[model samples]
Target: MAEKEFENKVALVTGGSRGIGAAIALRFAGSGAEVFVNHRKGAGSSKAKAEELQERVALMGGRLTAVASDISSRSAVKEMMETIGREAGRLDFLILNAARAPFKPIERLLERELRDLIQVNYMGNIFCVQEALPLLEESAGKIVFISSLGSRFFNPAYPLGSMKAAMEAVVRDLAESLRPRRVTVNAVSGGIVKTDSYKVLRQHMENLDQLPEHLVVEAEEIADVTAFLCSPAARGICGQTIVCDRGMSNALQRF
Candidate 1:
């Protein structure tokens, strides 16, 4: 692929301040696309990381703009899309990578936790899609949701799985509904990615360290596949959730 394959294009990645979202932002920016990295609205680690990502992209001669928004709020999402339009004029890719949920069983979740689980992980992402629809349709763009194996398999304390599952269903529905408009919708179900959150998960699922080295999936690997889904190569694929888990999801394993 040419270094500037996405020249003049624009992409927005939610939760792009760190981890898989950060990698995806770098991937698109590295390919010469102007990227908008979305972080939750606040000053703290998330904002710091977004700034760091911006500097890194600048060092690489890539363009990135950090946008702050709480996707759970429809009003915030709307303002974000408006900002992107006013600044970038067009959007070619929308990566639904933002998610927020506590690590705990569904049955044990408190009222607040339950609301957050549904609001941020599920409704928040859907809100982005709804807000970005106009720009996407104008550009006939692509949308990719960042999902996980938790959506299919039962994890020790992963209530987030239910939301991922729901978003995957939305992906299917949107793919069909947006087909005529040439807006493609898809997802990537990652497996056991060693992100910052992994440290927290380790406390609950001690066996994560026991998985074979070869089974570990890198953030960049997921980003590469995500880029493919947004490229011309994936024009034929729609309403599909591609699993980029390094075969970890193929069968049961003894830890």
Candidate 2:
């Protein structure tokens, strides 16, 4: 791919202080896009990660800005959008990568916990898109949501899965609704990723070698796909949940 595929474009990645979100922000910066790395908190490792990304972009002669905001709150998201508009004037890509939910059985979860998950994972995404729609439309941009295979499979029974399923539906509906405006919306559903969020699951599973290579998708791998989806190369794709699970979903069979 050309180095300047995303030249003159601007991207916003939520929860971009570390892990997959950090990787996505770096990839965008590498591709010559001005990236906004959004984190909910501004302390400790998250702050360090943001600083590291800023340094990387500087070394690469790219543009990167780290913004702190809680995506689940409407006022915060509004403020974020306002900052982007003021600073960059327009947005070419929006990656909804912030997801928060406690790991627990459905019965054990309190009503507040479930609502929080829905608010952060589902409504947060909706809010980001709602706030970013006009800018995206102006730039003919794309929106990518980082989803999980849990939405399709039966494993990892948590309230998060239910929220993911609902979010996928929203992705489809939004894609269709935004089609007329030349704004594309899609979800990249990944398998078990090696991130802090997966530590709990890793403890229960033994013999990692038994899993397919594709099943262990990396942060960089997902970041690459996200960069592509934001580029002109993915203009033909829209309203689809592209699974990056290394055929894990296909490998499962039932009689």
Candidate 3:
């Protein structure tokens, strides 16, 4: 119905089978980008969600391929990138949107659990970036990491917030290193979003009523900001964490 913004670009979105990742994949494809949608396990894992998205892309006359891989593994990430290079020729955008964690209290979290969190959320990101750097450099691409407000504020429900904080540091460091190469790196920290992940905390949604209707961020909203960051308009805006929390971050706290 409308002109697409990223007509010639090729994008790779990790964990894109559903929720925020799904929204990002659809948005990029809608904007005319050839997208590589990465997911782990089989289609049976997410069922019709992956097929639904693939069909949507086809209907829009956009190119997309859904691949399955465990990003926490270095060899898996390497093979994924190799496939993209061979098929897409070059990569123009990377969205690290996949993460895993178990809800537990800080003291209750096992050392093994912490290690798993680090591997999936932090180390997985590092591996993806490193493997994709060559193609990204060739295209002067944009890399967007999907973080959360938990990285900045205390969320007792999610003991894995510390890993998000670590990722914020990674974003800054990577941005600085990639500056000379013309590739931009940034993190999008979203507030409470309505997604399958949020279903676990739906009980708290009522407590958020005091905030604006828009304050409850949606997956698509995050997708929109992410797409903008990957565009030419965001070329000068690098090494920054853009908070898409609908001003929730600015509200004064009550004692």
Q: Each model's number of backbone clashes?
A: 0, 0, 0
Q: Which residue pairs collide in model 1, if any?
A: none
For all predicted structures, in order, the TM-scores are 0.98, 0.93, 0.93
Per-residue accuracy of model 3 over 1-255 as CA lDDT, tens digit each: 666799889999999989999999999998999999888776585746777889988998888898888889999999999999999899999999988888766777889997888899989989999999999999999999999988888766676578888988988999999988878999899987878778765443345546556678888999999998998888788778899988888866821
Worst 10 residues of 2 by lDDT: 200-209
Off by over 4 Å in 2: 1-3, 204-214, 253-255
- The lDDT of each candidate is 0.93, 0.86, 0.87
Candidate 1 at residue 71, lDDT?
A: 93
**CA lDDT for candidate 2:** 0.86
Per-residue lDDT over 1-255 for candidate 1, one digit per residue giving the tens place of the 0 to 100 score: 455779999999999999999999999999999999998966988889999999999999989999889999999999999999999999999999988878888899999999988899988998899899999999999999999998899997999998899999999999999999989999999988889888888888988888889988999999999999999988889999999998887888746
Q: How far is candidate 3 from the true structure (C-alpha RMSD, Å)?
A: 2.2
Consecutive 10-residue window with the lowest summed lDDT within model 3: 202-211
lDDT of 3 at 118: 85
Q: Give the TM-score of candidate 3.
A: 0.93
Q: Between 1 and 2, whose lDDT is larger?
A: 1
Top lDDT: which candidate number? 1
Off by over 4 Å in 1: 1-3
